[model samples]
Target: MMKGFSPTKYILKSFKSGKEFKDEGWTLDAPGEMEPSLIRAIYDKKQIDVKDDSWGLYKFADWLPIGRVLEGSSAPVTYKSEGLAKELGLENLWITFSGYWPEKGTNMSTCSFKETEAYSVCGRMTPEMDKVLVVASAGNTSRAFAKVCSENNIPLLICVPEDNIGALWFEEPINDCVKLICSKSGSDYFDAIHLSNIVAGMEGFVAEGGAKNVARRDGMATTTLSAVTTIGRIPDYYFQAIGSGTGAIAAWEANLRLIEDGRFGSNKMKLMISQNLPFKPIHDAWKADSRHMLPLDDDLARKQVEEIIAKVLSNRKPPYPIAGGLYDALKDAGGDVLLASNEHAHDAARMFLELEGNDIHPASAIATATLIDAAKSGLVKKDDLIMLNITGGGEEKFKTENELFYLKPEIVFDINPGEDEVIERVAKLF
Candidate 1:
């Protein structure tokens, strides 16, 4: 068993009820099959004090829920952006990047922030799981989890839309323990999700629990953890473009942990989350001052998904309204959703490349553009500390030096499949 690690406690983030179960691996009690409410791990940051020198994200082992992380794990890299700050007329702009920008030491070769969650999610798993983990993602997430599980020889079955399979590329061939399942009839991330749920019901497979997984939320929380450690205090406004808003929630969770640590200051950082236009579900909901999503309001949002520049920002159903999820995070942080046009994101990407000499993912460009708007609208002042999570970037640079190995799906299926046929195909791999 992995040693030198033990949870301080696991509690319902809403109820704060986990002091009753005083050990690791306790199942959180919940009603109905929705896995109940999300659970969070609480740690004594001082007693479990994280040594700053530990490489990558492991430096924050004091707060990470997982006992073990993959070897050579990477963390979100943060830096004070002089050029972009000057361009946007903001004096205190910090960039937290997670991708293959080597000079920044960002080694997440998937070129996505999803790797943060991947390492943490896989880290929490062990051989004793005895079941293959089934994950559904649009692109970046599937690629991130596949890369991490492959490196560690952990069993994973990834379900992704057929078109998004191209994004599931790695520098090396995938491990034999990992399997990719393509959803042929699936048109979007939601379709892929529908298919994966069916596959997860089989005898030897387990759903990775999309948004509800504590490991993922805590893992991505490291970006926030890294920012506070470097800035020496939480920023005034935290920014990121999110599909599921899970990253923003992770940031909020990490903020609570830092406050509890009693060393990272007490003020809450405001969240300025963004979404690309033509498909802004969360943005529309927040605009209407609603906690629960009003899909009828953004009916055109679904019709316009293909037109959006940032396809990854097209999560039709995010974990926003759930208890302890995005809505709670935004409310806790005094946050609002930022909306951007294709022109907005494109302009930001151009400015970033010209000024910073680095390319940002479209989703990240949306965030960058929103930050500029926030500054111009006087919502944020010149010297307010701001942390912009460039959730993913450096793809153009990464491709210049590396060869990508794209894996073909071992099985192609639809939302409803013959159970025996799916099982037979998967059993052969195990």
Candidate 2:
């Protein structure tokens, strides 16, 4: 452990078998899994004490499964909404803003909530571990990880789709310890994941276990922690746009913890999650009330991804069907999946800027559009307290404030490169 923190502060519990185990460096699953399940961090502290604002995201370190607190981190800023709430005629709408809005005291430099994952996942690392971490992303995640790893001097290898490379722009040149590799043009997030999986298996490389990592999920759970602590209680509904649906699952997990704390009321917030239209696998699966996703052809999936405005939400293999995943979270929380079209998402983005004073990501816009529809359709009552998680925003403002330097990929590989060829080329980068 890193000096002051204790590993015993939390235990990894298997979601399916109810088995608990200590953290063994990078434990993603239970020792002997009877069924596929998500491993969650069961923190020892039942009542969470928020640290000083100087701690940034570490304010909730009592709950996060991290060995050390990362510097320059910022927690989600949750406040009662005025502009959008009044426009929709809602009396108690709370917005949890997670990007670079200085006026709102939000400071996620990457302009994405993926920073929560990056900081906690990387913070879980110790000096004794000597392996390069491998991460895969559609865009936002890679940028967040790259920025964190670069600043912290942690060796990292990022695999992202070539089409989304523009999202890698940073305020300064990244450190040499962080190297990027791209899945060539026409590939999607799944292709990037495939390439990273092969590379992660190679010697001296460790996979940054995406949604499976307890640190990541617990880190994302901070969004809920921030909202509940700020709102003084759990909201009636929670809304967000998802690619992997991991954020919604994290929120559900946080709700359970807060309920156990005995301070927050024992109310399960309905998870009102949305997906951008045409590339809505989770939405389709949830709407059908199926634990398994309907078979989607590779070509058809890729075509749908191409048709969507929110490229970051183009995840082909989201953690929806697994035990203790999105499906279970939705069933327990009681909510429906909604869809937003590209045009409506664009309109919502503009409206958010005009009303909220900050531009949002495409995925966030989809979420806003869905919430608007819900309010207009009477799915949500006027006086009900609702939490709309603006997962990312303020990119346009950040761009105008800082000169960005884009990180160039160390190597670009075909969508499906041979394992030997990849191992050989990637090994040489170090």
- Per-candidate clash tally: 0, 0
The per-model lDDT (C-alpha) reads 0.79, 0.92
**Candidate 1 residue lDDT tens string, 176-294:** 88888876743667767777877788888888887777788878988888788888888989999989999998899888778877787888999899988867779888888787898
Models 1 onward score TM values of 0.91, 0.98
Q: Cα deviation in Å at residue 218, candidate 2? A: 0.8
How does model 2 fare in lDDT?
Answer: 0.92
Q: What is the Cα-based TM-score of model 1?
A: 0.91
Candidate with top lDDT is: 2
lDDT of 2 by residue, 36-151 (tens): 89999888898999877777887888998877776788889999999999999999999998999989898999999999888888888876889999999999999999999999
> 359, model 1: CA deviation in Å?
1.2
Which candidate leads the pack in TM-score?
Answer: 2
Predictions: Cα RMSD each: 2.8, 1.3
Residue 55: error of model 2 in Å?
A: 0.3
Q: Report the Cα lDDT for residue 272, model 1.
A: 91
